[model samples]
Target: MHVLVVYESLWGNTEQVARAVADKLGSVGTVDVVDSDAAPITVDGYDLLVVGGPTHAFSMTRAATRAEAVKSQSALHEPARGIREWLNLLGRPSAAIPAIAFDTRVDKPRMPGSAAKAAKHELRSMGFGTTVKQETFRVHGYEGPLLDGELERASAWADEVIAALGLGSRADR
Candidate 1:
């Protein structure tokens, strides 16, 4: 199985999670990971697509939110374009390609909503089949190293995704 993992991150927390997911998926098959800014606007050959980003303003980051992040977070590098724009450019994919969406968010009580959920809805609207439910990994704060064990949790989720796709060990191949 070939997989593509794309992500948009401001403080690097979401990028870490994307790498973890891609690394785990790599154990099962070929996986390519790219930042949303660097990702191709089309999904042509991949069998699976995984997209993730940080939650901003209860959903994916908008241009305004990205500007705020750049202005407020001195350590953050300027993002060329966020996942929202990347997804918008990717109108739809062939029905054979399945997708999963994830996001990194503050671990606060009653956090308004999730970017992963919003992304999943968008993917569905674009006619992509989702093999797994949208997932979220928590961060202790806005700029984060990720909450404890989140990377392990993300890797485990990749295992579940592989199983759902009916891909057994690739050792024999």
Candidate 2:
């Protein structure tokens, strides 16, 4: 199976989790890990899609125009870019593929289910099957030293995805 893992990261915590997911998913099949900024991804070539982002101020970032003309004005209104805009720009996949959603967020003991919830809603609206489920990797500080052992946790999560999806060769079992 071919899997594509795409992500957006402000401070690299999300990137670390994306890498761990890609690495673990690769253990079962071919995987391509991409930064969401690299546009025009061919989702038709892959069997699984994994989307990830970071939670900022309890919401996913809102998409914005790049030109300076709207920057100041949009900054006041939009704030951040959400994966929904990115997926919308990419358009819906040609075929419905199973997908997993994830995010990296500050481990505030109080804050719960913001980014992952947003990601799942966006992905389901895009017409992907909600098989792999939404998950979160922890980040300690804003810039993220990354909660220790989160990568391993991500790998373990991916293993569950593989088993649930029945991916991997016979030998992999």
Candidate 3:
């Protein structure tokens, strides 16, 4: 039940959510939460792949978008590579490994489009099975202190994903 939680975060909000999700998943099995660029080239050893990123221009971040975020100087941290580029560079897995996607977006003016949705397509395109449905955590604005309780919700979502997969191996459960 090894899990790989890979993500791209601009303002670190998405990174926070990613860690919270990985924390819950740790009860099930080993979990490695890494930046998208630092992720493995292949999904060979993992049982599940959980991916997340901040929604940029309504989808996964691009080079231009990331540059813009950096230019705006609003991000606490910027990923060296975004999820979009990482996926492109990833190797095609031999099997359709189970996966889920998540994103951080503006909480107030709920927008159209989702990094999660786009990520689902990318993962499926790369032969990964889309297991649990995609989720979107919210932030106050672009560069955000994540809206309160999003971390809790992220952990809960991890448990739900495991349940949906019938993994039934949470350490506490």
Candidate 4:
């Protein structure tokens, strides 16, 4: 299974989760991790897509929110287009491409909204099938060092995604 993992991280917390996910997927097959800004418009030649970002204001971050993250908040990089915009502008795939969505959020407050849920909805609307359940990794606060063992859990989630999707290592394949 060739997996393309795209992510938008404000303070590198989300990137950590993405990396853990890629590590597990790499065990099964080839994997590439790309920042959302650099991801291809068309997701072709890949068997699976993994999209994630930090939840901003209960959902995916927008231009204004990203700007705030860089200016008013503690994000290290300059503000730019994020997963929300990338998914919006993504070209439809020629064939059915399955996807999994994940996000990083504050672990303390237990927010109601989820970026993972929103991202999966967008992918489905764009004709991508989702075989695995959406997930949320937690952080201490907005610009945060992730909580303990979240990376391990993210890696384990990747394993579950592989099992659920049956991408490879199946007798049929």
Candidate 5:
């Protein structure tokens, strides 16, 4: 199966999670990891889609950035578009193939939810089934030193996604 993992990161934390996810999917089949803002991906080309981003101020940071871009008419350092807009424009994929969503955030004692939840909701509206509950990996600081064990957890989560989606071993695709 061909899987596409697209992500938007502020301080690289989200990318790390994306890579770990893609690695696990790679074990089962072909995987492509792309920046969410690069271009709108055609979901029809892949069997599964994984979308992720970073959380800032309790919401996906990329969404605010995209909004800023639209109002400012200038490209911002973050990106011009977000996963939500991309998925909305892509319409629905042919199959109900499962998709997974994840995010990276500064672990705050006050806040529990992550940006991935919003992304997952948007994906569902766009007609993709989700596998493995939405997840969040923690970061130590704003610029981020990802918290310990997050990568391992990401890989493990990917394994779960594969299993939940009924995908076979890596070699079988």
Candidate 6:
């Protein structure tokens, strides 16, 4: 199985989770990990695609929200285009590719929404088959060192995704 893992991260938390996911997926098959800004505009060749980003304003970051992140976080990397824009530009896939979506969000009292949820919807709209429920990894704050164990959780989630997609032959590794 070939897998592509793409992510948009303002403060790197999501990127770290994406890497963990990719690393775990690597055990099952070949995996290519890239930032959303560098991801392909079309989904082809890969059997599975995993996409993730930081939750901004309750969902995927827009240009305005990215600007806000840049203004508020000194260490944040300015991305050319976030997952929202990348997905928008990525037209519907020609064939059904199994996909999973995840997001990094602040561990607030009541987080309003989820980027993963919105991303899943977007992927389905783009004609990709979503094989796993959307997942969220928590952060302590906006520019965060993710909540404890989130990376490990992300890796575990990757294993689950592999199993769900019936690509579990190498998951034990």
Q: Write down the TM-score for model 3.
A: 0.94
Query: lDDT tens digits, residues 94-133, model 4?
Result: 8998989999999887878989999999999988998688
Q: Please provide TM-scores, in order, for all candidate models, with all chains considered together.
A: 0.94, 0.82, 0.94, 0.94, 0.85, 0.94
Consecutive 10-residue window with the lowest summed lDDT within model 2: 66-75
Candidate 1 root-mean-square deviation in Å: 1.5
Candidate 6 runs further than 4 Å off: 170-173
Q: Please give, for residues 74-126, the per-residue lDDT of candidate 1 as tens digits.
A: 53855778888999999578655789999999887548788999998888888
Misplaced by over 4 Å in model 3 are: 170-173
Residue pairs of candidate 6 with colliding backbone atoms: none
Residue pairs with backbone overlap in model 2:
61-80, 61-81, 61-82, 62-80, 62-81
lDDT of 3: 0.89
Clashes of each: 0, 5, 0, 0, 2, 0
| Per-residue lDDT over 32-123 for candidate 3, one digit per residue giving the tens place of the 0 to 100 score | 99999798889898888998998888899988889889888567666778899888888988777898999999987888999999999999
Alpha carbon lDDT of each predicted model: 0.87, 0.74, 0.89, 0.88, 0.77, 0.88
lDDT of 6 by residue, 46-101 (tens): 88889999888888998888887888776468788989999989877777898899
Per residue, candidate 2 scores C-alpha lDDT tens digits across 1-173 of 88888887766678889998898888777888877776344588889888888765565655533222135323222313346566767667789988888888777654755667787787788788886678888887555668889999999999998889888653766
Model 1: weakest 10-residue lDDT segment is: 71-80
Residue 110 in candidate 6, Cα distance off native in Å:
3.2
